[model samples]
Target: MARQPALSASLQPTLGAHRRLMAGLIPEAGFHAAPLDGVTFMRADANTTPAPVLQEPSIVLLGQGLKRSYLDGEVLAYAPGEILVVALPMQFDCDTVVQPGQPMLALSVRIDMAVVAELACQMDPLPPLPPGAPSAHARGLSVAPMDAALADALTRLLEVLGDAEASRVLGPQLLRELHYRVLQGPAGTGLRALAASQGRLGRVFRSIEQMRADPARELSVAALARDAGMSVSAFHEAFKRVTGHAPLQYLKLTRLHLARSWMLDHDLGAAEAAYRVGYGSASQFSREFKRLFGLPPSAARSQPVVPA
Candidate 1:
């Protein structure tokens, strides 16, 4: 009980600094691209209506407010002071809420798989999987307490955002350090597993990349299994374990996301977007699009569109 005040005092400055920096950097409620590649700052001034978002594999640090992600009937919420690490592309409904006077503030840094692999090589070998440990599929998204080192690194990273030269010179190093710190934190095991080239999860990650690259291609489960060096049944089990979705289901979601991107970014018509993403029927595409996004493709034109 005696230590509580001291702890709170210690945390006050860091939290206050983060809040100030974010408030100054973001003047409105939307995603703001940072000068650096693969980094974006987000702010929301009030509770948001739930919206379907296709989030890439990334590390998200929340400095204020609360976020809830609904996926596969699971509700994952991350409060301020926690780090959310997503190890795979995820399509989910997300909403944010904040105290009356505060805004939702966060940093979203896309994960560089190559960097993860390089760092994993220098770290100590990971231990064997523990008995009854959750499979990699369900482990794709993790929320863990942020340590001081990571918090400090993130704060420093944002401090340099206003200076382009400093951001160019120092941003990469700080981002690397942030990744290293996360690799050493609670989500490290799952991250390391994903980075291992010969590991089961690693192979699954490779397969995911292929699917994303050409969602329109005729991809067969047998071929994907062969590429992963696993039998069909084994591949199915492993893929589900690592990604939380069956192969066909994952493919469907990927295609639908790509189709939406086409309609928004390229201004493709619904039929054209459907055909481009390998949908054979316009009605089928519209149905799925409405099901996932809560609106038909035609209605999506009015909504704000961001690059996928």
Candidate 2:
């Protein structure tokens, strides 16, 4: 059976310790790596402006506060006890809602395809894909209400991650349980398709992986399509169906995301960051960068937070 949150929908089963555990784990307002592998704890003291950011495959759960993500003219607003799952790397605009006294606390669990593949094989019959999720291979992100089973697993996982011995012993099992529960969710179909790695979505995913592997490469859409064993138009349609963005647009956004990371995480200058990401002309790079991130590269260099 699928999991549900502990308390009433709005309360999120804070029954006792989850919020307290997060408080002890997170010391300040920033994204913090946890003791357990593949898990991160996040806290934000103030509201964050909407900005385009790159999100890799992971499970994001809001424990306190609300977050709204914008994509393709649609708005996805999720509050506490709600979870968002992404099957692949994507760039989207995210805005965190928080107040001064009441901060936002969140958790991020990175997806492991190896574990997903193993689980997909073990289950006698895979969970049914939601009707809204088309083609049994559409890949992107989905938000759903957290049920009791998942909420219990997450609470236990947090408790286990708090202690050294418990984290070493039980963390893996709890982590696996969380992923298992998600596999039965609205987003399961895409994840299963990604795990199978043989269908059209699998082929499209490989091309995306190529872009992620080396955004600096001047990859042609035709070449990517050929490698996927599909014609250009077919590949284009399939790619958009799954990832929301067209092939070249996805590549450009990937390059811009890489440049932003270089500037913020590595302190690279504007021109250098653009050049590293395959931008030949600094002027053109700057123009495109601003158009996507809404700020110049220089601003990223000084930005203190990578929002949770």
Candidate 3:
């Protein structure tokens, strides 16, 4: 990947302030979800091993340090002054780089597709697609250099994050502005493709949303394809092409991820977690969980911690 331009001198102080504010929010090293909606802060103090991470729809902005993401045989690397946008929920192998004295600090702002689509309509329309432009299908994952305006908005958002009243009263408007900025950015292509749900990518995303919303519900490729208004073969191909996983496989991963989260965050037991995710058999859930995560369902609590 081409190296992004360094953060200009004029933007350094705001970037520095962003870093400092994030550090203060997370005094220790771990994944910390802020009181505000859809805001998650993370601090990684140690160099982390490449771990499978289920990334939701969000934009990951680094205050400091670097990260390499491995997905579908493609490796993407990003450092400070760059942002990673996930237009869909997918799994990736993430490796974080933290210097000995300086930990990696980052924050994720979750994306709400409905809100994005609404915001897109409120703004000036995007330019028409050029001749021979690629289809609406998008990778749903992209990295780009952060724009100065976006950086300034983030800094102001950070400034209000620590105060409950400010977060409640001012955060929404600021966050909305950030989303608008994103829609106008280089990384906005994937989002636009997803929002303009008149093409194959949008159809596939529809199925994805269904599976993610109710992972325990009975689902099949044929049914998903039908709902997407495509033949089984066409839907299967489109789903895998965009998400890097087959439809059924994607649903399975979603179930397993949810089950694991239930076990860890909500203190559910393996059997209960499996049942909640529609696993009729605990043994089967354990087997598949171990296959994907390299550990049994019961072992998830014991897995080494990493930034969320």
Best candidate per TM-score, number?
3
Where does model 3 exceed 4 Å of error? 1-10, 135-137, 304-308
In candidate 2, stretches whose alpha carbon ends up further than 4 angstroms from where it belongs are 1-17, 127-133, 198-200, 304-308
> Per-residue lDDT for 195 in model 3?
81
Per-residue lDDT of model 3, residues 199-262, tens digit only: 6667877898899788899998999988999999999888887777888988898999899988
lDDT of each: 0.79, 0.79, 0.83
- The runs of at least 3 residues in candidate 1 whose Cα sits more than 4 Å from the true structure, single-residue gaps closed, are 1-9, 131-138, 304-308
Give lDDT tens digits, candidate 2, residues 10-47: 44445245667777777698888887888998898878
C-alpha RMSD by candidate, in order: 3.7, 3.9, 2.5
Candidate 3 root-mean-square deviation in Å? 2.5
Prediction 3 global C-alpha lDDT: 0.83
Give a tens-digit lDDT track for model 1, residues 1-308: 00111234566678778778878877788888998899998988777767877778899987778888776677777765677888878666788877898888888899988888899999998766699875543457777777777778888998988788999999999889889989988866678788876566678878989998888888999999999999999998878766667778888888988888888789889999889878999999999989978789899887653211
lDDT at position 222, candidate 2: 97
Which residue pairs collide in model 1, if any? Answer: 137-241, 137-242, 137-243
Q: Compute the lDDT for candidate 2.
A: 0.79
